[model samples]
Target: MKTLPALGDDARVRLSRQGGFAAIHALSRPREIEFAQCDISQRTRICSVLEGCLTLDSTVSGRGDQRFYQIEVNYRSGGQEDRMVLKVPEDQAPGELVHLWDTGQLL
Candidate 1:
């Protein structure tokens, strides 16, 4: 199974207080953004991006039908999760997924 990657030092990570909640944004490249919203009443960070692309590489990982692509990502919010995962063939381009994931605009 494909797994997600960790957040890199390149991420412009930030946090903001929204009403009774806390929202975090981690942005990078060509205007992509990863966001999370959490309730402030909790003792820990609850909001999370879960999984989203941080970078894209053109190199192919395998050959023919057994092949798959990679997208590096900051998998979880609160600076806890990050990794690389296989790219999923979506209706939109891979960059679009990254944009949606970053901006919290995914449908």
Candidate 2:
């Protein structure tokens, strides 16, 4: 596994997509996205969508074939660490964020 770059007073968003009729596991590999490295608009969209979820640790129910996405966020400020995790149904995930998962480029 490759290590994500260190963040100093910055944030990171890691997205994991899994769960499908043809899938084997409940969760697929997670891709780490450096928040500061993303395009301004992408970062803004992600931040806005997740703004209500910065402190939430929950999951949304969905059908068997529906994909599940696990979003892991880590933030560091003032030498303190803040973390949040959210597993939501495919329809509930933001398109911009999902695009980042499908492709490393945040467009």
Give the top-scoring candidate (lDDT): 2
| TM-score between candidate 2 and the true structure | 0.61
Q: Which predicted model would earn the best TM-score? A: 2
**Which 10 successive residues of model 2 have the least lDDT summed?**
1-10
The global C-alpha lDDT for each of the candidates, from Candidate 1 onward, is 0.33, 0.65
lDDT string, candidate 1, 1-60, tens digits = 333333334333322111112222321222323333322321121113323322322234
Candidate 2 residue pairs in clash (backbone atoms < 3 Å) = none
Tell me the tens digit of each residue's lDDT in model 2 across 1-107: 22223443279877888677777653576787776677677666666656643333235434568787777779885688877667667766667656767775556
> Whole-model lDDT for model 1 versus the true structure?
0.33
Worst 10 residues of 1 by lDDT: 15-24
Task: State TM-scores per candidate.
Answer: 0.25, 0.61
